[model samples]
Target: MKGRTFKHAMAAHCESGTLTALLNHAGLKISEPMVFGISGGIFFGYFESKKFPFPTFVVRSRPGQIRTALARRIGVKFAERRFRNPADGEKELDRLLSLQIPAACQTDFFYMNYLPGHVRVHINVHFVVVVEKRGEAYIISDCYSPELASLNRDSLMKARFAGGSFAPKGFLFYPVSVPEAIDFRKAVWKGIRSASFYMVKLPMPFLGVKGIRMFAQKVVDWPRLARDTEHLSHEIMKINIFLEDQGTGGAGFRFMYATFLREASELLNDRDLLEMSKRIMEIGDRWREISLFAARIGKRRDLGPDRLRELSGLIHERADAEEIFFKELLAMSKKKK
Candidate 1:
């Protein structure tokens, strides 16, 4: 029963048993891939800052008997998942010792929410660790669930101030009352609240539900849609054209349009949509062929715009019709669900 309020948390660092000073001490010995974070939501930063490139490893630390409660209800993705299993807890604990304090490490910070109860604080912290092989930065990313995101009725944009202040509930900590490491985490996540992961740095089209899971959902249903082959012909043709029309630099309006629609397609299930989807597939196939041809002709530079316009014409011509069709498809999908 350590104090549960932020005011009590102010003197948190005074506890030498906490992870903050431990991480600071660890930093004195620069080393390789490692992790040092609380269990309840403070992110670790090694390779890059949150706003830049690098990945965040979410850690859930515990030094208590009731740690059994965490065996399953809590889970995560990314290298952070390295800590997911029951067997690796001791190993992760050791690795934490070897980790160096991220260059940006701060003695102060803030965050949100909390998991109540117990002897040792049960909190989760997010960390930014770089993937390097033989000493070179490899990849960067963020771990978040859309389901978790959708729970936000607040529609909070990832803001500079978003995770900045120590949350009203104070920082998320690992395994209860056991000297909380909540201070540093609250300080850190707040620092990088508006930052995007490395994957986001690339000039990607950023289509909806930006994740492999979301992408997979669209991909999985594709096979089911394939059974309607004949109806797919024109549909595919239109789709290819639309994809190309997505615009000039392979960025902006058309890119967003095509990417967004591909995701939007997932929301519908109308006969017309199925019909249109079939055409979209056609165009997707044809575009590959056309792109190949353009490469051969050295006319690829013009290919993008030409294709975008040709494809856009279909949707443009049947704008209202397609909207109604897709809306019906959406309604249909809801009914099926």
Candidate 2:
């Protein structure tokens, strides 16, 4: 197979984007927003562990759940594999590419040399599709990249085998089949319900809307945890990057989910959903404000307690808004049932 044969397109989030591309390549047309929404991809979680460099938070569901939940809901079959040895993984990927198949791979972002240096963090859950091989390089379609990119064999291997939290372990997957017909209406509602349930119903304090609250409460203590003022500023500015520029489709996926809701409303012809979609868009705007505020304060080196307290207040407000939003969404799900 020749390199660059697979069509490359950028998307909001890597996991859902890869799934959308695979499904489309298999002749099952679907939008990224639909895939994301139906997969229950929006979520929040706060973490402070010794393994991590500093306190952090997540704005989406656990890695790989999007594909798993999507397959179950939409009757798609994907062939998945994980390798204990990097050489074996490379051989398998080559075999697939030789057959003109595009395979999605899990890799640590730090080793994707195609990315800009500033964004090359050690996130292990980044997804990209290897389309073909040319000499010693693999042509890849990364949702984060605006166009097709190439990674050498050594860098690819290192990325696939990178150790730490959420290691890829040389994982790869491809869509084997998709059903001829699908019940999108049912799938949308189920997805919304699942997202709502995970957000509002999760018992853990550090997950879901509760997790947002924890983030709000803990952010005020970030100065104490940082190595210095500059460190605190960097972490604070990361809030903006995580929410907007990190392929979240803006506002930590609130905007994308709003798009999903609007699309679902049109498909289901439900006025209530249309209204809720508008509401969520407004909520996303508020989140954008928070991101901007964090960026501004951090860039200005305004790490005083008073500024952090103000930031905490903004997060707390978002938490309250999300709690109400998810609860109402859960109620709406019941009515749909």
Candidate 3:
């Protein structure tokens, strides 16, 4: 542990980035997009509950699914553990660091002291790798940070044990083994097929492309939920942050998944996938346009009904495009299989 080095690199999202880093550290050279796509990371879900101060939407699959799907698709094994007692979690983390094992910990984003206060929130599913321990502080490799950061033992403990939805409960994982070789072709096709199925075939009305449409339909009603105009404006602006700045690599993971398709096309030598990659990239661009529009109108405090309807139209348009795009993708995957 003393002599070994853990390379730290910034990534678009926390879960995929941490997985890529751990896999790379374990001698498997893979890109973040490849990891994300192979894990079926792109998704959409609209949620309204008391758990949040305002209604929100998610642009990716559930946390921990990335690791689980990767293990199933590829022959990778991870050593994972969770603790009911916070003290035991800290002890196990220290033991892993002592053995030179860089452990990935799921903790609340709000407790990461290195981030700017404005950017921090109460998300309990954020992932960070503890590269090493130094006295009372641990060296952290957070995906969002440009450089390695440090977190005190007390802060780390609180983050790991944070109570709420998706509570981490001191969860941690690290790669234990990876196959000497990987079947990129089969993996890529399976990943793409699964993503398309989730988007177009899932039964849940509040998930996938249907969720996007629901968001469009329900957004006009948001004015009733807000405390005032400023609150409404702030929530609208958060759409931009969630889609771009909060780690979708831009366009709510559309851009990253597009990158994966391009890489998969080159690797598998499939011209159709290459063409699809271009199309998804265009779709991602449209999503970016929506985010920008939301940000601008929100900043201007233009929350009138007409403006809201225009925003809803923009979202619905994206949903239409995605429905067609994913169905085509599903057909392409079936043909390739």
- The better candidate by TM-score, 2 or 3, is 3
Instruction: Please report, in order, the local distance difference test score of every candidate based on alpha carbons.
Output: 0.24, 0.93, 0.94
Residue-level lDDT tens digits of model 1 in 51-144: 4221111111122211122211122111222222323532342233234211111111111111112211212222211111121221211111
TM-score ranking from best candidate downward? 3, 2, 1
User: TM-score per candidate, in order?
Assistant: 0.21, 0.98, 0.98
lDDT of 3 by residue, 1-337 (tens): 2346899999999999999999999889999999999988899999999988999999999999999999889889999999999989999999999988999999999999999999999999999999999999999999999999999989999999999999999999998889988888888889999999999999898899999999999999999999999999999999999999998999999999999999999999999988999999999999999999999999999999999999999999999999999999999989886
Of the candidates shown, which would achieve the greatest TM-score relative to the real structure?
A: 3
lDDT of 2 by residue, 1-337 (tens): 1233567899999999999988888888899999999999999999999988998999999999999999999999999999998889999999999988999999999999999999998999999999889999999899999999999999999999999889899999998888989999889989999999999999999999999999999999999899999999999999999999998999999999999999999999999899999988998999999999999999999889999999999999999999999999999998895
Pick by lDDT: 1 or 3, better one:
3
Write down the RMSD of all candidates, one decimal each.
21.8, 1.5, 1.0
What is residue 200's positional error in candidate 3, in angstroms?
0.5
